[model samples]
Target: MPSLDDQPAASDLHHAVLAWYDMHARDLPWRRPEASAWSVMVSEFMLQQTPVARVLPVHEAWLERWPTPADLAAEPTGEAVRAWGRLGYPRRALRLHAAAVAITEQHDGVVPDSYDDLIALPGVGDYTAAAIASFAYGRRHVVLDTNVRRVFARAVAGVEFPATAVTRAERDLATGLLPDEEATAATWAVAVMELGALVCTASSPRCGACPIADVCRWRLAGHPAYDGPPRKAQAWAGTDRQCRGRLMAVLRESEGPVHASALAAAWDDAVQRERCLVGLIDDALVVRVGPESYALP
Candidate 1:
C-alpha cells in the first residue's frame, strides 16, 4: 500500500472542494445545468486568456446572434470576427468560426462527445476538448486548465505556480486526483478550477476563506515566493497586439471595406499600422476586398 506521504487523500480533497463549490461557485451561464454543449464550447473559447467579466457581455451577444454552431457557420467567417468586438486576440474568433463550421458540416451541429473528436475541431486543443467532454458530457477526463493547474500547483504540489508548460509529471498528478465516479470527477474538475479563479488567485489570494486552505500544501509550507523563471506580464500598449486592436476597431466599426488611408487614421505609425493590418488579414480576421481596402472575413 502507498504511504500517506505519497498523495493527499482524494476523498477528503474532493469533499472539501466540492462542498465549498456547492456554496460558492459562480453562476456562469455556461455552468447552468440547462446550458447546451455549444454554449459551453463557446464559453471556453471566449474565456481563453480573457477575464470572466469581460467575456460575459460578448458571450451573451454572440449566443443571441448565433444560437447554434450551424447558425454561426452559415454566416461568413468575417461576421464572426466582426461580432467578436475588442475581445483581444481576434484570432480566437477566427478559430472559433472554423470550429463552428467543422461542427456543423461534420458533427451535424452537435458538439462532439469524445475528447478525440472535440480536439479534431480547429482551435480545439487539449484543454478545450477535455473541458467540453467533461463539463458538457460529464465524462471523467483530466481537465487541467489554468485555474485547475494553479490549484493543483499550490494545494497539492506545494508550489507557487505550475511549470511554464505542462509537464508529464503534472498530468500524472492531475490524473491521480480524478474521482472514480464520472459525474463527481466532472464536478471536481470545475470546482477546483473555480477555487483557483476566485480564491487562490495569482496575487492577493484570499486563502483564509478557501475551503481547502487547511489541507493546502503551499499554505502548510508557508507560501514561499515562486523561485522559477520570472513570469512576464503581457504588454498591450504600443505593441503589435495593441496595434492590431486599433486596426480591428476601425474594421469592426466600418460599414464598407475600409480604405488603407481610413485604416491608417486609427494609428499614427504608418509602418506598424500596415504590419497590423496585414497581420489581421493573414489571421483571417480581415479580408482584403480591393487593392487598398479590407473588411471582416
Candidate 2:
C-alpha cells in the first residue's frame, strides 16, 4: 500500500478541487439543494455506467411521473420498465423499481440517511449506499465511483489507470484523504468526481485545465500509458445484450402483450431471439403473458 504521507496534502488538493467544482460543476438537477433524497437515489441508479447527457431527459421524465418512492411503488413494475426508454441496461430499471418498493414499504417512502439502512434496500450496493449517504444526506463517507477511483489513482498513486477492480490499498488511500468534517467531505467527494468526469476523463484528460494537475503524481512522474492486463471493450452488435434490447424495445412500445411473432420479426436469428426471450422472462423484465405472447413485467 502507498503511504498516505507520500501523497499530496489533503488540504491543498481539497481546496483546489473544491474551488474548481464550485465554479465549474455542472448544474445537474440531482445536485441541487432542493433535490429530495429519492431524486438522488434515482439519479444514482440511472447514472450507473450511463452518461449525464443521456440521463438528463429520462431523469426529468421519471421524476415528473413518479416524484416519490411511494408513487413509483404504487405502479406496476412493468411501468417502470416502459419508462426506462433506450437506456441500454434495462435491468437497472427493474432494480430501481424494486428499490422504490422496498423504500416505500420499509423506509416510509423516504430514502435512508445511514449507509447501513441504505445498503439493506434492494439493489443498493456498497458504493451506492455510500453515495446516497454522502451526497443526499451530507454524511461523512468515502464515495468511490469509477471516476473518483481514477482521480485517486492518478493524483495519489501515480498510476495512469486503476486496477480492474478497486483494491484494498485504494480504499485506504480514499479514507485517508477524506476530510474530517462531514459537509466538507461530502463536497470534496463530489468535487473529485466532477474533476474526474470533466477534466481527468478516461480517454483524453485535459491536464492543463485540471486543478490538481501540478501535484498529480502521474503528471509529475511523466504521464505513462496503462500497461496492465488488456482491457476489453464492451461488445454491442449481435451480442445477447443487443438481442435482448431489441426484444425489450418491442415490449416497451406496445401497451398490450406483444405476440411472439412480433418479437421474432424484431430479430433475425430465430434461435438467438428465442434464447433472448427466455432470458428476459427469467429476468422478469419480460413476462410470458400467453403461450405465444410476451409483455413487460
Candidate 3:
C-alpha cells in the first residue's frame, strides 16, 4: 500500500514528476506567470467537462470581451450566456457571471487569493477554488480534478480509475502528498494534473512517456483491467441534452427574442421539444420575452 509516508521512494517520485513538469508543461495561457487570478478562474470554469481545444478560442474571446471581473459584471447577465457559445452546460456561464458580479460588488473586482474567499464565489467549487489558489496565487492545496485523481489512481493505488466519486481516503491521500513548501506543493498539484492529461490519459495512457511509469503501482501490477463497477459514459445523440443544445443554439444565434415557432423549428419531436424548452426555462437558460416569445437569459 502507498501510505502517506512511503518515504525515500516517494521523495524520488516527487522530484522526478516535478522535473518532468518543468520541461514539458503545455504553454496554456492560464499557465503563464502573467495570467491574472481572474484569468485562472475563467480557465477553470471553461474547463469543466470540456476539452482544452474547445475551450481555447472561447476563453480567448471571453477574455477579449470581459478583460476583468468588473467588465463582465457591467454587462447584462444574458450577454454572458450568449457569449458562452455552445460550450455546453451553459449554467457555468451564468455561474461565472454571478461570480463576476460578486467579485465586483464584494471583492473590489479582484479574484480572491485564498481558497476560502474563492470558494465563496459563485461557480467556484473545491476543485476550482483550489486551482485558482494554487495556480494563480501559488498557495498549497490538494487540487484533485479528474486528471489528477486518475494519476494518483494509477501511480499510487494500482487502479485504472479512481472511485466514481471521491472518497475520504482519496482526499486524505492527496492532502498527505502535498509538499511542505507552499510553492512546491502548488507546482506538484499542477504537475500531477498535467501528467494525467498528457501521458496517463484515461483512454490511451502513454506509459512509455510517463515520468513516474517505473514506480507506478498499476504498471508494476502488470496493468490489470478494471473490474470494478461500470462507469457511465456521457450520451449525446437523440438525448434531451442535444435537444436543449439545439434550442439554445437558436436563441444564441439570434440577436432578438425568437418566436416559439422558430424555437420549435430547431427540434423535430413536438413532445420532446416542448419538454426540453420547459426544462430550459426551468433551468433559467431561457427567458420568456412574451407568452409565445423566448430569449436567452
Best-performing candidate as measured by lDDT: 2
TM-score of every model versus the real structure: 0.95, 0.97, 0.95
Q: Per-candidate RMSD vs. true structure?
A: 2.2, 2.3, 2.3
Q: Lowest summed lDDT over 10 consecutive residues: which window, candidate 2?
A: 1-10
Estimate the overall C-alpha local distance difference test score of candidate 2: 0.92
The Cα local distance difference test for each model comes to 0.89, 0.92, 0.90
- Model 1 TM-score (2 dp): 0.95
Off by over 4 Å in 2: 1-6
As a whole number from 0 to 100, the lDDT of residue 199 in candidate 3 is 95
Model 3 Cα shift for residue 189 (angstroms): 0.8
Q: Residues 104-149, candidate 2, lDDT per residue (tens digit)? A: 8888888989999999887789899999999999999999999999
Whichever of 2 and 3 has more TM-score, that candidate is 2
lDDT of 3 by residue, 1-297 (tens): 544334326687789999999999999998887888888889999999999999999999999899999999998878999999978899999899999999999999899898899999888899999999999999999999999999889888888999999999999988888888999999999999999999999988999998888778888788889988999888989999999999999999999999999978889899999999999899888999898999987
lDDT order, best first, reads 2, 3, 1
Distance (Å) between predicted and true CA of 57, model 3? 0.8
